[model samples]
Target: MCSYGSKLVAPWTIASPISAKICRLRQVAKRFYNFGSKEYKSAFGDAPFFDSQGLRERTIQYIKNFDASIWHKDPIRTIVKGNYFIQGVESDTTNAIGNINGKQIFADKETFEKITAHISSSALRYEVSKCKDLMKAVRRLEADLL
Candidate 1:
């Protein structure tokens, strides 16, 4: 995701190699702050990954230890904002992809129950078969989840 944001900042016409480098560094830093730390671990809990505040501390230390040039350019805010936007875009894209994949899986009535268990209500379950759009299906699913 950081790499994606870095690539987007390019072709600014006035951007230099140093500027690009800083942009990449800022993107990396934002990821560390956003999702790669103990804060993230505490917020999300452990499962696939181990619980290690040391690892998070080390990551923060590494970013803090970078050359002043990384902070001199101070592209963190822009990169963070761009990262947020990209996350939304990626989320929407994945939702669309899920809808595409689900169409095949939900082709049958019985299968819809398995899928709906996580996201659909009794009313939604009754009406979902009549839903003609992915967004409507998603909304029904979300309503059930809530």
Candidate 2:
């Protein structure tokens, strides 16, 4: 009789196809953000504001749109919201994910999910908005997924 080990194999080994597909998508997104099209740059560039309120409004809209577009394909795989900067795991693939002081760290799904849930629930969004650094905030969120 054949005997199997009690330990469960990692999901990556069990679901190579899904893992590979996610990896590919992540790569493409990263490439697009890094060497993005002219339009992307223009959309994110600094703009003279008519007023502080107008600047805030535009920034909020831009951030929401940017986030929605990036996570549109897989909402579950994305960090929809957050408060204080923290790191965690993605729920689906157990990818390591987080943004430490603005740098993204993607590890495993379990870890990413924990961190994502925590930050998403915290006052990170308010704090981030107050800083008015939408690009850094967006980058922190996107880097984890990618």
Candidate 3:
């Protein structure tokens, strides 16, 4: 022990409030890391979002046509007709103007055309539409799948 005025300080003793707080934090972090090293429940537990097998399959299939180099999995929150869905981002770093519920995905014809344009050229065929039939058909197909 060393004397600082009338107080005797031990080598292992925390000398200040900040050091005491830091020691407590290190103990907590050690416990947390040790617990994490053992088998543990998932961070999200069993959320419904992780259990959607059908939706997962469909999303995978649809995204397979997209150009991986130009687009990545960036979830964007969207609401349509009072319902919410997680959309994606466009190549231009803009929110993809679309919404997909349990049923069909919906967007304006222009948005739909613009997003689909990001499909890999090898897998895509270009079309110039004069009407809304294409988007309607896409919506119908999406609805039928669900």
For candidate 3, the TM-score is: 0.24
What is the per-residue lDDT of model 3 for residues 29-143, given as tens digits with 9 covering 90 to 100? 7677745433453432343645589888889988887654433343333443334443433223333565331232345565555445533432234343576336444554444
Q: State which candidate, 1 or 2, has the greater TM-score.
A: 1
lDDT value for model 3: 0.48
Per-residue accuracy of model 2 over 1-146 as CA lDDT, tens digit each: 11124554444454467755665666677767845577765657775656889889999998877743334244343343433322444332323564222223344666667666766665355336665457766676565434
Task: Judge candidate 1 at residue 8 and give its lDDT.
Answer: 44
lDDT of 1 by residue, 1-146 (tens): 22433354343342477666766788677666656567655544344755689889998998888664433233222121122111111111123446311111112343344445533335436344553434555655555444
Candidate achieving the largest lDDT? 2
Predicted structure with the largest TM-score when compared to the true one: 3
Per-candidate Cα lDDT values, in order, are 0.44, 0.52, 0.48
The full ranking of all candidates by lDDT, starting with the best, is: 2, 3, 1
Please report the TM-score between candidate 2 and the true structure. 0.21
Worst 10 residues of 3 by lDDT: 99-108
Better of 2 and 3 by lDDT: 2
RMSD of 1: 20.6
Off by over 4 Å in 2: 1-15, 34-46, 52-146
